[model samples]
Target chain A: MIILSPLGWLGRSTLYFLAATGRITLFALQAFSHIFRPPWYPRELFNALMQIGWLSLPVVGMTALFTGGALALQIYSGGSRFNAEAVVPQIVAIGMVRELGPVMAGLMIAARVTSSIAAEIATMKVTEQIDALVTLSTDPMKYLVAPRVLAALLTVPVLVGVGDIIGIAGGYTVAVQSLGFNPAAYLQNTVDFLEPLDIISSLAKGAAFGVIAAMMGCYFGMASGRGAMGVGRATKDSVETAAVLILAANFALTGVFFSL
Target chain B: MIRMENVTKSFGQKHVLRGLDLEIPRGTSMVIIGGSGTGKSVALKCVLGLIQPDSGKILVDGKDARGGDRDAFLARFGMLFQGGALFDSLPVWQNVAFRLLRGRLKRPQAEAREIAVDKLRRVGLTPDVADLLPAELSGGMQKRVGLARAIAADPEIIFFDEPTTGLDPIMSGVINDLIREIVVEMGATAMTITHDMTSVRAIADNVAMLHDGVIQWTGPVADMDASGDPYLEQFIHGRAEGPIEAVR
Candidate 1:
């Protein structure tokens, strides 16, 4: 019985995971289809864009800046052991543009936007506002989820581009001022090392991560149970799920873009 | 008119509605009164298509409620939710005019706002309260705003869920009177779910007592006290010892 119990528990867990994945995939497909349909709420879309994109700038900027600086310092120290300290500029540029910038921005958004979206929508569900929308002849999927997912999809790429520039600037500051590297030579090395494909992959990853973050928030919210505990759980699960999915997606996207 | 025939719904092991049957006539108010957790709200939600029944037929105006253009079907009805359910982000007027400002009922912003103010006035709110968010309003006022929003589009049918659940007796009386007056004036068919006998007395043209997932007693409001069903009698007198078991 004990050995069979372990198998039972594993099977139950696996089924639960599969069911949740199916629900989220269906929700994402519905929201994406609604984006192409008419009767779109421009006002709601604009509000979402401002909240997810413009409001997220400061945190995303700070994360990328610090991560860029620390990446430079770590690479320089490791390179010094091999007498390869001069490779810092190229490595920092490639690292920030290809990987760190988008992932960091996505994680920051997963923390900020995903939690907020989940809490707000879950509260609405608990209060019966979602039902009210349906009674008013508005499709909650189109009215609520589509606007948010679309906003995140459109703006996260822009945020990634901004983050990449800011991150390179952070590395430049650390290398030139503290590490005694020449300013013009460092800039030239950094610029020369970054290819257009690196920037495109970063922004592409940003868009994918954004969709995952917002979709997780909406899915958990609509599926929330009944009260304060339900809202809290939805918000917590949304951020955790979004962060993990963002990391996993970053790996897959990187493999697709850069793998030999 | 709305009718539910043998509707059944279960959430996991707990069956909320079991073969529930009901009928409400057009241009009349039907109040369904029951103890908490006896599936009154579930029945109401089923009629509105918010919660689908497991096995049953729901008819609105002799047409199957489940088969039709959902939006067109929904467009004929208005609902005032228990907690008001006003959008926290929108101002009072925008919330009131939500239907008029969007979808197939779209109107110019100015015209929608004017109609919103008119509906607000009908619900005893002033135009000055139009710009305030729902969170800024008191609970009773929020209920009034919800009522205003419900009738904003002049829907043919209106449903009120727990219209006086959380209010002082005076406020409850006022809301009940308003509900009764609005139904009469609008000449709209109304269905209300509540446990408050006072609300039932004030708002019902016909009353149905729901217990054990079925209608226990149903008759005109005047015949209620004399109908003499044990469940209805116990519920009306507020006695705990009866066919209905108190959860606690």
Candidate 2:
């Protein structure tokens, strides 16, 4: 065997890393192909809806409530500098509807669901459950990835819509109590500042973020290395990738909505 | 009726299979023996089309199995995984009847549950275990569940990957007898990969030894005792000192 020095070892490690990334990309492509095929699993899709959608609502709602409350406080503190406290209603309404609601929900899901999906599937993989699926003449991609991606696509927008409403209500509560704003007038101003375009944009962001998070989780899980250490690595990597990608996509989407 | 022609598979720089060829005749049990990472499992997977070979032809019943109708081709085979690979989220009956519920074989829930229960009974499990999750079962029970699932569909071909790994001696013997009984009764072709000599003695009609990315020796089970290849002798005896290196 050719002995590798420290520098050579580093180089070899980098090469292996790149190769694994390429392999993962290829696997993702194969999975995507199954999406366009027939033999869809309606039951699997329903199960995913329960896992990624209904079960996730409480966490998403709670995160939105607290974030909305905090945003209102921050805006009130900043707006007082210019006697611009009157702008609080429009700013909070617009901010929550356009960015904070969807982004916060997406990040929270990245923390909760992404790591969970990755760890669960990665462990199944290490233990050879995926091979059993193949032997049973079942496509694991169709059974595992399709339902998840579809659930993420369909449910996240709904989650965002709910988050937006709860967030606006949170802002309303804080504005009325601590900021000495009239309840009815604050609500009206909040309503006046919001547009159909802002709501659509938030929902759109939610769907995209949801798909990215699930895809990252499934991709990392299916490509996980051999043992418990490998499954742990996959979970961490999936969450990190989902969080970073959500932020990046959020920025790009913001630029898209606001630029033109 | 499985045939592999000059099959080779490589993961980057390391070659797992080097122009390997194998055939399992119809209605016979062929056991492939090898140490870990010796590509025994990979070869079985290639035949199942779970892993595509780099360059080779795999035929099941004289048709190209590699790129044909994958589901249909797979439907003709059953497999018992080394780890019993049952779906933890599903109950035992659903796991056993997975294919029956999902594909063209879709049946009503009640019927599927009944079939699943019958299959469980065939593996000596009770109907009460049907509603329990795989996680609730012991390792041996889980293996039985996996075995029950494998034979539930009663395919013409079966593949068993280390069917006796991580089991007590009595449980392993039970599993071996179960496998033998199923293969003989159903008149199905079987391909088994294991390092367990006892399993080979219990289940194989023909034995093939895989080492160094190729079949080192192959013969009828009766000839295994006297074939006299040093490598085969060393492996069958489980000697620490042998020409076979311990690395893989």
Candidate 3:
């Protein structure tokens, strides 16, 4: 329902946003608490691990490889403008391990896993499976949400590490094969340029982004309305929300790790 | 026994359940009948603690039904959902054995599967069907599987929501007969909500007619035809010219 006055409209919109934030925060807290409690379902957790982690590797790997190749080319050309083409290995290595690697992996999973989780859960709600779960003495948060969120939190960081290596390899292949760079020199420069902190921060961002993605999916799914349209809306909204949150989280994570 | 007193629930401006009261005796089958959107499901959900009425005192066996350990409270009840609501990812046996395989009621895997198979046979399903997913079964088979799951735990109280909503006439009759046999044989307390008169006749020991968010009429099923309440008559006869407007 809309109000006639602009002030009223603004107030209503603000209140709605605040209420939504409160609900999402409450759901996230409930999931966190349930995860620590007993009556755990190891089977559901293993299923989630395979779905969210192992199944996501191919897409994450391909995206990182192409991105790494493109980034190497762009950095080489840009550096040549300043007579600094020799900086290709250093810049590509740092750019990938520091930023692009985790962000890309997170965004990719957010698109794939988040949307699928949301749609499936929303459909279950529509079909009364969630209520059925409740009636069967099973909590939806424990059976459905905890496993998924925990699996994502554990797996996305590993995916990010794999993506980082593949991406760097792609850059190395491109540089040594086509850019007229020494294969040994390129590998040496890349090896010498990376530090442990860079990789650690990348994975830290991965973990944070993973939590955002899976949590958003479960929240939107559980809160979905009725009917087919409702399930569709939840799916669409989950991806959009997860993508936005991942980017915002990436920015905050970067500031925390590299601001100094 | 289940007793609901002065239950009132509202969603926005629409009052789905307004000051509704009902009493169902133990080991008796009570079926609530109403037109669509007349709060039948809402009332049932309230009793299950699936929906909380804005104000009400629901007593299950003389104890207040609200404010207790939810899992412990829910353990006493089983429900057959309108759409079957079986987990697509789970095999039929696992779905039926869900309660037995986990939580406070956990049974050994082999024992649980044995129970699930027995229940499936009781519902006219062959053991061969137990390994199939819900999606693999026909609608009637799915409904049978759901019924088996509902009674698998031997719950003292069972609820059926629109048990025959989307089935062919013969299948519906089969389900109705099966439900009647289960309730009579087990002597379990049963509450069902349905507009299907065939289902009502086959399943109800007592009948309650809901209209305008209240029980317009209620009595033993044998007296339903001569109840003399206009609302009940209008609904049972499916008359569009009665007090209820065709347009909401």
Candidate 4:
């Protein structure tokens, strides 16, 4: 094999990155295009919703609750240094709604749903089930990718909304039970401080992250090479790509929503 | 009828098919025989539109196979994969009726199930196995299910990819006979790619040998034994020494 110089290696890496990006963008566009087409399968969409949204509640909920509880304690201690421990409710609500809730939910989904989707599709490919689908005159994009992507796009934002509520409740429970904060006052403070934009931004982040997670899975899956090793690599790569893209998407969505 | 002219395909630098030409007439069974990795499957996939040729013309019934309404084109054909590629998620009957239960051929749920059971019966599967998933079936059983699925849509053409690859000797013979009977009964154009010489003899109306990315020999199955093409003779008689290279 010819050894590449540093510049050559860098150039090769750049080309690979661009090619991967182009493939993902096109796959996402095709998936979205099939969403509005006729001959839609409601059973598939519902199954996807159940798998991606409802089944994900336990993990996303537990993450939010624990994070919210921990945040309450940390902020209280940090605020005590300034004699402002009473700011716990407002800070916790804003924190979960503005950033932590959506980001954490997205990451959890990237890990769970993305890996699952990639492995399933890649395995189907290895067994030639995808080709069987084509032979049966069914479009794999519409049957596989479209339902999952559309379901994630619609349901993830709702999961974010649920996560936000659960997270705030966790903060409330910890404050009222352990920190001696008045329950009614804490609730009122949380409600008063959280603007609609905070919720909107959180949901928007969820939608963007959902699309990234799903599209990454489909792209890596369809682009998988061959064999058992290929399926494993596709699963690993999909989760990595989904997680990284979810975080990057979170940052961009945050900028769009919160930066002034 | 299906015809291919000057078909060429390569993945990166490794060329597979090179200026290959083939013609398959209507209502005949064509089996392409080649050594492992000799692009026999690739050739079948190219005609099935599962893969595109780098440069070629593939015509079916006087129309170009590619760049058409894909669903309409695909609906006219059925394929049984090498590994039996049954959907692990669906029961045996559902897998058999996969093409009929959805898409433009959507049948009512009960009607689809009935058709699936009927196909399963035709494939010699018992009614008890209809609700069992593919993982629950034996390899021979899975192949039968796959064969059932291949005939489900009753398409004008059928492609079988290595249909006897993983079966036992007796099972392979059984499957070979079943395939022969099905082709005879359906009167559908059939294309099969395999390395098994017994399978070649059993299911082929016509035989073609692919070596070095081109058709080395083509003739009626009876003529295959005495075609006098060295490549064909070496391959059919199972000689260690041959014109075709055994390894890359």
Candidate 5:
């Protein structure tokens, strides 16, 4: 019995994980269907967009700026060992556009938007506002989850695009002002090194990450237990799950776009 | 009219409602009283189709509650939740006019607001409170606002869950009287669930006692004191030494 205990624990954990994954998939599919259906709430959708997109700009922009500068500095320092310091511009541009920008923006959003969505929705559930919506003949899925998911889906990619440009600019400022690199030459190298596929992959990854973040938030929230503790747990779990899924998705999307 | 026959619900092994049978005739008020967790809310949810029963039938106006267009079915009902459950994001008037501003009952914003204000006035609230958020209101005021919202659409049936749970005696009495007046004025069928004896007395034409997942006693409010059922006697008299186990 002692020896089998470990196996039993593993089996239970695996089952729980599978069940959670299935529930999330079903929820995502339902929310997605509602997005295309009638009885849409434009006011709710616009509110979600403002909250998840317009409100998220400063943090995403700042993170990208600092990250790009640090990337340029690191590449320059390492390349100097091999007398290849000139590779800094190309590497920084490619790095920011192909990988760092979307992932960073996604993680930031997971921290900001996912936690906010989870806490808000879980509180609503606990307070019976969700039930109130149902009694009023408003489907919570269409009024709440669909609007949020759609907003994140439409806006996160745009945020990613913006982040990539800001990141490249950060690298440019660092290289030109502090590293004694020629400004025009640095810009040329940066632009020349980035392919169209790199930009597309970045934006695509952003969309996937956005959906995961919003879906995890809504799923955890709808499944939240009762009381303040339940709301707190939902918010924490949502952010953690969104962060992990965003990173995993970034890797998978990278492979899809660049493996061949 | 609403009816529940042989309704049973269980969460795992804990049966909340077991073989429950109940009926509420049109244009009458029925209040179910019970101890906490005695399936009062569960039965109500089953009737509203918010929760499905494991076995049994629920009929609303002689039609199966579970079948047909959910929107149309829901349109006939209004619910005032226990905690008031006003939308925190919307203003008082918007919350009150929620039903009229959207869906099949859609109306112009101006018309909806006007109706909301009129309902508020009927519920003893001022029109000045319209633009304020629900959080700004006191608990009693919030309950009144919820009541206003419930009657805003002039639903044929209204359900009040613990209508005076968190209020002082005077406020509770006020709310109880308002509920009674509103139901009578609209000629609407009403169902309320609460353990508050005062509220039960004020709001019920017919009274039902629920215990052990079923109706233990039921009759007109006049016969409640003399019903002589151990559960009903124990619950009404607030005695801890009767058929109910206090530790539960």
Candidate 6:
């Protein structure tokens, strides 16, 4: 009888919304639960590795190299006001490994892998392949998400390591040829500034970034709506979420490593 | 054997399935016929556990289909999707043997490939086609490959969702014949959804017409001719002016 009142109606609507959200959260939890079960797909993991790791190297490498070169030039010009141009190589090396390398690698991967995974899985969901997998005694999360997550965790660090090397090489190239720094001295300064902590932090960031990228892709993909527009929306949402989460994760990791 | 008792499914304010009930006997082929959006596909998906009904009980071999060990239950079934749903990144053989090569039922690569090739051959495809990607195959060939993959594990039950949707008439006929032959040879319980009367005639032992989320008529394939229900009559005769309206 109280349903007649305006406050009661608003309360009812709020409760309904909460119930809907609870159902969605339960759905997402069920998906995550499948990650630890048996029937792990090694072949799918291999395929994901090929897709997420090996193929991603060139693009991530290219992006890092360009950013590193630009960073080196900027640092050289900025340091000139204090007659401190010699600081260019060290600052560029630290900047690449500490920030630009991982962030850029993460963003590039979010752009590349998230859209592809989301679109592919969304199409599969739409076309009933996910259903087919379910009817075949297979859990789609285990068969789909786990393998990609594993590959991303194992491979993105390797991608970041490669990116780090390329970026430093980029900085060195510009410092030696364009900034009038000697090759031996630039390499020495880079080596001196890059402590093991920097390397470990960079790798840790890579692993976190990888999980964020792949999770967003799988999450949005499995939850996509119907039709072409639905798939397109899922793809866009996956990329955007992956990118934002990567930067956020990078910030947290950085804070943990240095700020505290 | 499969049975759906008082299945009711609704999305928001729209009712898709309303108090529907159906039964399928073991080792028989049942073709469900209806217009596009009449919930035939939804009914199939519900049986397969891909969609959950608001109220219903689906049983397989007298056991609840929604019970525990769902993986074991699903393992006995295979499905051929409407669009083939082939993995583009993998070769044809790998796609066929996807189930066999993954999970607890995994086979060695060599054995998986061999089985894939054998299944392909069973569907009237050659071994040379195994290495090619799905994108390289024609639509009919892709359907054949999908058929091969469906039967790869020699499942006891199979479901086909518009298996001949995109192919030419000749290709459709070939797929229809292949499905009929495979179902008969394996003695597998089969369920197929299609609006194509030719397919129903060619592949069905029994025909069930779904309209307004309920079975309007169901009988032996021969009895479908004399069903006499105006909806069935119009549907089978492909008439324009009947109870059933075109989407337009």
Stronger candidate by TM-score (4 vs 6) = 4
The fraction of correct interface contacts reproduced by each prediction comes to 0.97, 0.91, 0.85, 0.91, 0.85, 0.73
Give a tens-digit lDDT track for model 2, residues B98-190.
888878677888898899999999889999999999999999999999988998888899899999999999999999999999899999999
- Candidate 3: list runs displaced more than 4 Å: A1-4
Q: Score the docking of each candidate (DockQ).
A: 0.94, 0.77, 0.87, 0.85, 0.91, 0.63
Over B56-147, each residue of candidate 6 has an lDDT whose tens digit, in order, gives 89999999988978767878888998999787777999889988887657789899999999999999999999999999999999999999
> What value does the lDDT take at residue A149 in candidate 4?
94
- The better-scoring model by lDDT among 1 and 2 is 1
User: Where does candidate 2 stray beyond 4 Å?
Assistant: A1-36
- Please provide, for model 3 over A79-178, each residue's C-alpha lDDT reduced to its tens digit, 9 standing for 90 to 100: 9999999999999899999899999999999999999999999999999999999998999999999999999999999999999999998898889888
lDDT of 3 by residue, B113-231 (tens): 99999999999999999999899999999999999999999999999999999999999999999999999898899999999998999999999998989998999999999988888
Per-residue C-alpha lDDT of model 4 across residues B1-248, encoded as one tens digit per residue: 99989999999998999989999999999999998888998999998888999998999999999977988999889888999999888888889988888888889988888988888888888989999999998999999999999998888898999999989999999989999999889999999999999999999999989988899899899998889899999898888887776654
Q: Model 5, which residues run further than 4 Å from truth?
A: none
- Whichever of 2 and 3 has more lDDT, that candidate is 3
Report the C-alpha displacement of residue A183, candidate 6, in angstroms: 3.5
Model 3 scores what on Cα lDDT? 0.94
Tell me the number of clashing residue pairs for each predicted model: 0, 0, 0, 0, 0, 0
Q: Best lDDT goes to which candidate?
A: 5
**Candidate 6 DockQ category?**
medium
- Candidate 1 chain A minimal-lDDT segment of 10 residues: A251-260
Choose 1 or 3, whichever is better by TM-score.
1
Q: Higher DockQ: candidate 3 or 4?
A: 3
Question: Candidates' TM-scores?
Answer: 0.99, 0.93, 0.98, 0.97, 0.99, 0.90
Query: What overall lDDT goes with each candidate model?
Result: 0.94, 0.90, 0.94, 0.91, 0.95, 0.89
List the TM values for chain B, per candidate. 0.99, 0.97, 0.98, 0.98, 0.99, 0.98
Residues A1-260 of candidate 1: C-alpha lDDT, one tens digit per residue: 98899999999999999998998889899999999998799999999999999999999999989988998899999999999999999998889888999999999999999999999999999999999999999999999999999999999999999999899889889998899999999999988888888888988998998999899989989988899999999999999999999999998999999773
